[model samples]
Target: MLIDEMLHLFYPRVCTGCHSLLAPKERGICPECIASFDAFSDADAAGYAVKEVFRRNYPASNQPESAWTLYRFHKNDRLQRVVHAMKYEGVHRLGNVFGTLLAEMIAGSTAAAAFSCIVPVPLNRLKVVERTYNQSEVIARAVAGVLRKDVCTDLVVCKNHTRPQAGLSLRERHSNVKDAFTPSGNVVPENILLVDDVLTTGSTATAVMRALESAGARQISLATVVLAA
Candidate 1:
């Protein structure tokens, strides 16, 4: 405890969202910033967004279970900065903080206890070799820990390394990611939760879902730290 106090004295903990010093009881985030972030409340998620996602993916038939996101991705804001920090700067603990908040939302949802396994969006081999870690996997581990579930880190692997998705259109992103992911083997849990850091056009998650379904997954639910606009 004394060492922790001394560390804080030397390097005070700052809120990931607001970049402000946090109080003793507070963690990497402050209470005010937590209250400021918009999450998927019952009313917000009451719409057919999840169902619509399924329908869009499966125009003729039923899709998978509903998807849930933790926060609405505001444009070029503080939350964006925090996400960038975690993804690019190796601030892995930030992923845990984001995952903890998202886990709360997941616990209150219908698919709370339905997922048989959690799988994160896999980083490509070259990128993984460069970054030394996948941020989505870190978040997935944190989420599974909170939910008392198991994580399947080896279920999905990025089969191909492609150009960066920066400034790419939705269609371009889809084309770039074609055949990008493959399951490691023939076995997959009946109900799986595919986790990622953000969701923009649902292209990436949808692609991953298709791959999982091809691998014999019965149901899949999408979860992410942020939902992009």
Candidate 2:
């Protein structure tokens, strides 16, 4: 304990959100910063507002029946700082923290009981090569641990590197990710909980879910750490 304290004196850690010096037990963002995040659902549950997200962005036939996102992501906010740190700044552990928080909100929900397995949305090969990790996979693993469900990491994969969906129109976004993902094998899943870092237009998620459906995924639900408006 003394040695750890001395090392911290020389090299202090800081919160990602506020950039304040961190206590030993604290991880990426401080508790206050997490509390300050704007939530889509105020009821402290993994609310169903993402259902509307799916309805608005996805084709009626391809819409994800249910979905959940932890934080409402906005520009230049604490949640954004946390996301940038997790996604780009190499603070990979933040994904686990957010996933755990998400699981807490989802533990007793219908989605928790309905999902037979968890599958993280696969990352582009280039991003994985650059980051050396998949943030969504880390999030899925943590969620699976809490939910006591199996995680299927090998079933779905990106078949092509699609263009970035940022700044694209809804039609363009759908066209970009279409046919980008495909199932890897014939094994079927009863109910899949698809996990990802963030949700924007739902185009990417829709494409992946369609692939899973083609591969015999019975019913698919979406889970994300952040929802970008």
Candidate 3:
């Protein structure tokens, strides 16, 4: 506890969106960035980019349903930094901040009660060993805690350590992730919430959804902290 205080004192938490130190009652992003983020919320442009992936993969009847996101990912923008810090810089606490916002969104959705379990998009075994944690699981645990839902961190496993999906075309991304995830034979409940830190091309989520479908999960919904618009 004492060490934590000293760290915060020396490194006052800065808003990832604005790089400004947070004020009382403010967090991860500042007021100005919050306002700037609102313009990207058009459901088709920001939220349903995931749906677009589904359009390509399956007919409308076969596509999985999805939920929206909280913010947009601007390349070189503060939201990008926010995701970077959480994923690569050891700033894991932001998962709670992101997860709280996520839970609030989930609470208002019709599928809220349908969710019987929370499962994070899994990280590769090598990456997990290197990072010492999975950012998706961190966020999922926090969201599950707030909603009083069970988390199945060990249910889905990333068996292969492949290249990072960034800068890859959607086709390449889809090819790279094929069969990357497998379930551990856990009986997936009827409804499961799939959590991730970012939704870029939605290929990862789509792949995970297919794996869950094979495992017999009837419904799946995707949630993320930021969506690349």
Q: Find the candidate with the highest TM-score and give its number.
A: 2
- Candidate 1 off by > 4 Å: 43-62
Query: Candidate 3: how large is its RMSD?
Result: 3.0
User: What is the per-residue lDDT of model 3 for residues 118-203, given as tens digits with 9 covering 90 to 100?
Assistant: 98999998998888789999999988988889998776777778789998988788889987988878887778888999887778
Give per-residue CA lDDT, model 2, range 124-146, as digits (tens).
88878888888999999999999
Clashing pairs in 2: none
- Residue ranges of candidate 2 with Cα displaced over 4 Å: 1-10, 42-46
Clash count, candidate 1? 0
lDDT of each: 0.77, 0.82, 0.76
Q: What TM-score, over all chains together, does every model reach?
A: 0.88, 0.91, 0.85
Task: Sort by TM-score, best first.
Answer: 2, 1, 3
lDDT of predicted model 2: 0.82
Q: Which 10-residue span in candidate 1 carries the lowest summed lDDT?
A: 42-51
**Most lDDT-accurate candidate:** 2
What is the Å distance of residue 98 in model 1 from its true position? Answer: 1.6
User: Could you give candidate 1's per-residue lDDT for residues 13-85 as a string of tens digits?
Assistant: 8888787898765666777776777666752472245546546644654354767677776778777777888
